[model samples]
Target chain A: MNRNAPGYVLGFMALLCAVFGAGVATVHYATRDMLAANERLNHNRVVCSAFGLPVEGRAPADYARAMEQALVVATVPDGRGGARSVYRRADADPPVVGFTFWGMGFWDRIEGFAVMTADLETLVRLRFLDHKETPGLGARIEEAAFLDQFEGLRPDWTAAPDRRVMIGPAAPTQAGNRVDAVTGATQTSSALMRFLNEELERLRALDWTSLEFEPLPGSEP
Target chain B: MSVRARDIFKAGLIGDNPVYRQVLGICSALAVTNLLANTLFMCFGVVFTATLTNVTVSLLRRHIPKRVRMIAQVLIIASYVMMVDTLIRALNPDIHRFIGPYVGLIITNCIIMGRAEAFAAQNPPWPSLLDGLACGLGYSLVLIAIALVREPMGFGTLLGIPLPARELWWHSWTIMLMPPGAFFMLAILTWIARSRTGAKETSA
Candidate 1:
């Protein structure tokens, strides 16, 4: 319904819209560095929790302190099934065996972090960091019962690499080192166990003798 | 004034209501009204942008070139949107997060655009501002109404304000938080509003 008054006015309006959008994007850019830091810290806390490292509380403010006690490390594997430290903690010794990884799943991205012992043969702790599977169905992986099965799990996935962490057949009271998978979440359990199995195998192929694990403050020796 | 201030207010509140009548800006209504607190924030941001942009556009309508009116409209809407976006982020960081990018997306809200074009373009500046405010009020009222109905049933609570001694006795409408539930509830509310107002309803 608006009939033109001037051509330049259209140009001015286009220019203004550009400026406004650019301004918003620039604001995001200026804060990009800070946001990345926040995300890194969030990911760290999630990894720590997976490895069962304690945080002060679940509050956002408690994240930095939780992160201070833990660190991230990457392992570059050699052909012999042993991983070398590509990355390690700043505060700790040479090799930090804690690492986090993720992959696509049926519903959402599935990811977690595992903190292995300096020997790389023991999975001392792990946290199911993130997932978007059905809430009551597949999401049980984030719960403690499902995740805790891996605690003190003798890096078995590395050595035996072919076994499944089955919830069926019988209870763990009769088994040697098997995890009792969550009921009603068979697919989720399989995906996680498979992911963990594959990742640990890859870690085992890398050289671990060169890395140092950070000493967790006040952790029982 | 070409359009009366009373008409400005009444048209937005009842007759030409953006949420119920025109169905122009129901996105936020459907998305944010699942919780009372979320609906409240969404409504407030819409109101702020609508009112401010209406005034700015109405003031500039005469000067704006017809060919570039759309572009001019964007700048006015975006400026106000950014101001509100920044203010909300600084004031309520948690809700800012819970609501996330929805607050910024208010810039694209068709309510602001529709009002700017239909009402603000033809009305005096003062009346246009009132129309914007009333439109916002109408949106807020219906959003709260939907939220009041949905939240209690969905979460056994109101606006995340927990009810004491509550049990999960009633089966929750699992759909309420999903996009389909929003469409369903909004459709029902619009039906009620049109039938009561005796106005012909047009789907958004």
Candidate 2:
């Protein structure tokens, strides 16, 4: 147990290195391709989910194929800087402005991306993409019940994406807007409301006047 | 290979169970057991580190300097742990993410270091190797026991994958996968082991 000796130290070092070196060599040879493929797929799937798109069942080789026909990435700006949206399917005849949305909860961050309809007033689709919040408590943000609440949401005159959701049974204060928060997750809901406002205001400030609206393939009324 | 190896293996599995007996690797047992797959990976990592560390520590004990031996021992342990981390990142990166900092934390697991200082530094290489393997298996056994209950109860499934349609009948005890559940499970396990083995209070 005594630690001061030189020969003991050298011997220990040699034995330890020898054993670990062998382990590394074995692992390197066995798992090189699998790890690389995992990292690539994980990143791609998150991007797909960000746009309300799905990629769960597809194998790695099919990811590029999914991206080709399914998604469209557009650059949009926030107060912080510009953001992008890779919409799963924007069915509008003329595509409108797109935005990336995000929020902070008690434990971690929640974020997603969305594509708006041609008029810039209605939502194309919204998806919650990433979060690291506490399981069962804050993690409920990932639940479909919470996410589906955002499906038809749109702006009104008084309730700009500027004000936070007051939560706890406060009715939506304006037309074309709603505010029924998830039970036991008020703080998270409120934060989401605030972030959405900030993101929307930033979207409003952008100079979209010069950008041409191309008629989208599926934007039929 | 020898009777000693078998004895060491058996001791870890039954005589000196890590989670239920010594309760040595409880931190990971609690945190990762929330998912069966995570627990299984943690067990694999611990076993690998303990077995290899023991054999090396034993082989080198003769030349280790009295004053500087602890530092060298640490260097040895850290080397193995880091190597595990790198290989995971390179080979099994998905599991690596779930394992997170625990790979680095393995150096401080006390079990590996304990075996090194206790038996490895004193024993021959073969026995040392067996002791390491035994300790790892022992740790895995207790962890799997906890995982068996915790995963199924918390997530309403076994391991990361789901159970058969028949077992879908079980109700989820949501807390079984939480931190408090770990404490409860560990306590119950300790009680069971002590009562069954009639272990000496001072030793446990």
Candidate 3:
């Protein structure tokens, strides 16, 4: 057999792909259940934290229970031909609405969750789930100093994009939604503000009362 | 150990180290070495991928067409990396969440492909496996050393445990936790390793 022959090369490549692909598929198949469970548990943990629920030293079962009692999911059109998840905390003293949002950061896409008042006006907390921002600079968005400012922030939805939620320097007396951007990370901070305002605008336009909500899987009704 | 095996280890560990000597896979070394725990997992993934890819590539060397050998090697490396990613996710979900981004990077780590091309393509299975392990360890050694210094100085802790009397003596050096810190540490480590080995690297 001529190894250099086109047919021979194609056959060899196909065989190799099949063999190695099968090996990887087998491993994935074996761990699919465990991975799914891990994702669910992690989701529960994040939702619990976002809603100010207890998570310290708690078991997976505990988080799942908390999620079951408090959380509901609703899908909303994400302007971009796709559906975005909106999580509503059913059991909070003043129910909270949480949704995942992502946008390009300085280096790559940044994904995070934001929980707002049930009325979707003021922010309760903002936390990042994944990012590839430059370490020590844009990555500082994950730190408390950067995120804490979001608490109690009320974006001026009626205002322009730049004025809706200002991330750059602002005085204490400055009006509208303002959070100090991470020093030396203007790009990331600005990028975050851009996507956040867009998401907030989208959320504000939605009729939350009209959107249907269902229990998160594995949660009690 | 047999003379052949001893020579392979010596070359991989020192003379032909994938990191300091060959200067391959530095992206990951720079990215993950800020934390010891992350570095350890990255090392395990690299070692696993390198060793298994070498053996498989060597086993298939005879049949793999020269025109598509690189593609085949990558496919093989990627499969192993996928397995490592899934296994880590299953075994330690928390760590996986932190290191998940880095796991996919193993397939692109130059060290694995370097071994497959430079040594594994011609060597027997056992020897290629050893060479892969040796090179992986060489890379691991450099990364772990950097992490050991970076984590303690940057975070005032080792493996997340606060250092003794940290409140009194430890003031975190912010640079040590960033990419610039990894650059300084890597340069220093490469300098030390090269000085001790007395081997000069020629530009390829």
Candidate 4:
């Protein structure tokens, strides 16, 4: 049998695909539970961090436990005609809401979670969960120095007609609704601010006052 | 040359070090070395991908058609990389997110393909596996060395451990955190390693 024959080539290719497919499938199936657990752990960590809850050195199970015990999950209209989930503290007197939002960054999409005050105009904390931004540059968005600026920033929709948050050069003395952009990552900063504003606009349109809370699966009420 | 396993291993670790001698996988070495934690995980991913891909390719070398051997090698490498990616995500989601696309980009790292074609294609399975593991180690050693320099200087941390002086007086070098710093570090490291080994420089 000629090694270069079309029959041999096709047969070899088919065999290779089948073998590799099996190998990959086996790994995927084996790790499915661990992967789901890690993902849940990561999401819980982000939500907790956004709400100023301690997460360091804690197990993912612990975060899940904390989230379950303290937060109530609710689905709300995303202002895009679709519903998105938001979490609120089950015990807060006035109730604070938290949600994850996505934005375009320098290299790829950035996802973050933010906790907002009961009035829905003030940010309590914002923490980036995942991003593909260039390391050390746009990736600085995840750094505490950059993200901490969002805390207590009150977005005044009247400041911008479209209701997007304004980000500018570092102004430690400046007040109200404006965040200081990461120095070298102006593009990522602007993109994040733009998306936050857009999401905030949509979030503003939602009726947060009367939303009902439901316990997430596998969580206690 | 009758290649023994030790020689194969030493060749990758030193004689034909991927980063210093062959200069094959500098892309990831530069991109992920700023954080020691990230560099270590990336190394694990590369080692896992390379060794398995090599063993798989060597086992099938005879059956793979000459014209389609590259495609076959790629499929095997990609499959192993996907497996590594899944494992990393499951075990360490934080590092997985930090490295993000670079994990998938391992499929394109030249060191894996270079060994598959240059050494693995004609070698026995065990030897090919050694070669792959050696090359991956060589690449990883270089990355770790660069990370050692970059992480402390750039971020005032070692594997995320904050240096005492960082809080007291030491100011982190911001440039060391950026791409230009990686370029400079890689250049210096390759030069030092090659010069020490008396290896002839190849132009990139």
Can you write out model 3's per-residue Cα lDDT over B1-204, one digit (the tens) per residue?
899999999898888888888899998898888889999998999999999999999998999999988998999999999999999989888777667777888989899998999999999999999999999898899999999999999998888899999999889899998889999999999899889989765899
DockQ of 1: 0.23
DockQ order, best first, reads 4, 3, 2, 1
Give the local distance difference test score of model 3: 0.87
Give the per-residue lDDT of model 1 (tens digit) for A1-221. 33453456665577667766787677666666655655555575666564445678766556655655565444455334554433244444433457665566556678777776655656656776556565446766767877677776664443357452333344445454477776787777777767766666666665566554544444334
Q: Fraction of true contacts kept, per model?
A: 0.29, 0.49, 0.83, 0.93
Which ten residues in a row are the worst by lDDT in model 3 chain B? B93-102
lDDT of 1 at B194: 89
lDDT of 4 at B204: 100
What lDDT would each prediction earn against the true structure? Answer: 0.69, 0.68, 0.87, 0.85
* Native-referenced DockQ of model 4: 0.71
- Model 2 misses residue B184 by how many Å? 2.4
Q: Considering DockQ, which of the candidate structures 3 and 4 is the better prediction for this target?
A: 4
Q: Which stretches of candidate 2 lie over 4 Å from their true place?
A: A1-33, A54-56, A74-221, B62-68, B86-97, B160-168, B202-204
* Tens digit of per-residue lDDT, candidate 4, span A1-221: 79999998999899889988998999999999998888777788888878766554697677877777778888887766677898888677566889888877787888888999767868889987778887667887888888788888888767674444678753444758777777788898888877888888777777776888888667853
Q: Compose the digit string of candidate 3's lDDT tens values, residues A1-221.
A: 78999999999999988988899999999999998888777766766777787654678888877766777889999877899889887777678899888899998899888899988778999988778776557878988888888888987767785567889876554665888889899999989998988887788778877899999787654
Report candidate 1's fraction of native contacts. Answer: 0.29
Q: TM-score of the second chain in each model?
A: 0.90, 0.91, 0.96, 0.95
TM-score of each: 0.63, 0.67, 0.86, 0.84
